[model samples]
Structures are given as C-alpha cells and as structure tokens.
Target: MSRYEVDKALWDVYRDASAAKQYRRDPVGFLAPRDLSDEEREALAARDVRRLVALGSHPFLTYNFALRLAGGFSMPFVQDYVGQLQGLVVGDITT
Candidate 1:
C-alpha cells in the first residue's frame, strides 16, 4: 500500500527466508542482529517506497534508499523495478 509497507513486507519475507543453518554456524553473530517488528518494518518500507516514487526521473534512487534502509542494494532487482517505472514515465512524457 505504502512504501514503508512494501519495505517491511519485503524485509519480513527476507527474515523469514533466512536459513537457520547460517545461524547455527555463527549463533552469536546472527542473533546479535537487530530485530524488526512487523509494524516497524511496515513503516520503514512505506517511507522508502514513498521516497522512490517521489523521485520521478530518478526512480532508481529507491534502490539506494532501500539499501540504506536494510543495509545493501541488490542491483538486478532494483534495476528491474526502476527500469520498468522509467519506461512508463518515458512513455507518458512522449505522448
């Protein structure tokens, strides 16, 4: 629904998908990581998504924001999303 909501949802999914074996290998390192409640996750997601949407021509900006949000960027995924939006905007501008 909102940027923060999207981010939080994505984050929750990411957390849930993390392998326990990884944690087993380094319990203290993994467990020491921060925990984000559903509500907080949603709020942060919404904020980042909103910022991305607001950037207009710089749709790719969201990827950076998303990374700054969670830690790092995934270029393939971010580029895909940004490229799609940029295409749509270009179409609109041309018409």
Candidate 2:
C-alpha cells in the first residue's frame, strides 16, 4: 500500500471547508485516528510542508493544506517548501 494514505486524508480534509476548519482547530486530534506513520503524523503535527513534499506528497494538496492551516497563503512559506522539494529532486537525480 502507498504510504500516501495520510496525504490523501489530508487532501480530503482540505477539500471540505468544514472538515478543514475542524482540522485547523485540532490537527492532532484530527489525525489521531488515522493510520499514519510516525513521520507522517509528526509532519502534520509540525506543519512541516517541506518534509511532506520531500516525502512525496502532492505539491498542490500540500499547498492547499498549508493555506488552510495558516488561514491564508504566504509566498515566503511556499517558496521555502518548493525550494526544499527542488533540493530533494536534485539530490535524487545526482545520486
């Protein structure tokens, strides 16, 4: 099974405003029942966008999630997250 079940779950939450609101209010409780790995759980708890992207989360979904969690978009945050993804991709290509 794909480890991205967590990503899909996050996307589902982001797809619905009510769900996203609930998630934003209590992210740990929201994710507590899901069958996510430690890394996935930690990433969500920490709001670690870069780690999520590096772990193969869909960038669009990740961005949406971040925006919802932050109550708006921040260009600097997106730039940093995308930069991390670029670094990971470049590392993969080189290795």
Candidate 3:
C-alpha cells in the first residue's frame, strides 16, 4: 500500500548509478532497506513490471527502471519490458 516507497525505489535506480549498480548486484538487498511491502519487494526483485503497475507505482518510472534493469535502453530487454506492459492502461496513480 506504499506507492511512494515503491516509486522511490524505482527512481533510486532510474536516477542514480550507484543504486542501479547495487540493484544489478543484489536486487533484494538493494530494496531491503526500503519501506516496501513484501509483495513490493518480490515484485521489484523479479522485475515484475505488470505487478508493480497493479500495485500503483508510476508506470513511467516503472518503465524507465525496467530500461535500467535491462542495462540502459538496450534490446531484448526493451522488447521484454514492452511485452509486460502490452495492452495496458494506466490506472490510479495517486500516492
């Protein structure tokens, strides 16, 4: 129920190189200190963008974070990220 924390986590990686490196090194560990629900932690670790969206994280941040996870706007990753978000509509984003 904490979209603020969830989106902060996404933004951490999306905007900071150290955070992104930490994420690549240890996804769970990187998020361990964040005030996120277990479900949120699992979703982020698993890179489950759809689940994150459903959890109310900002879709734009989620998409950008996915690109970071895919090593910066590269192939296959972009396609995979796109697939996860296919046929989608952004829902309530209030945090």
User: Which residues of candidate 3, in runs, are more than 4 Å off?
Assistant: none
lDDT tens digits, residue span 31-86, model 3:
98889999999999998999999888998899889887776766787788888888
The whole-model C-alpha lDDT of candidate 2 against the native structure comes to: 0.71
Model 2 superposed RMSD (Cα): 4.3
Ranking according to lDDT, highest score first: 3, 2, 1
Give each model's clash number.
Answer: 6, 0, 0
TM-scores, all candidates, are: 0.26, 0.72, 0.88
lDDT of 2 by residue, 1-95 (tens): 23467677668777888878777788888888888888888887777877776676777777788777666667886676566567565122111
- Residue 14's lDDT in candidate 1: 42
For each candidate in the order shown, give its overall lDDT on alpha carbons.
0.40, 0.71, 0.89
Q: What does candidate 1's lDDT look like per residue over 19-93, in tens digits?
A: 333433443344334354444343333443443343321333344444444445577756755654563432121
Off by over 4 Å in 2: 73-86, 90-95
At residue 67, give the lDDT of candidate 3: 84
Question: Which candidate has the highest lDDT of all?
Answer: 3
- Residue 10, model 2, lDDT: 65
**Pairs with steric clashes in candidate 2:** none
Q: 80, model 1: CA deviation in Å? A: 4.7
Clashes of 1: 6
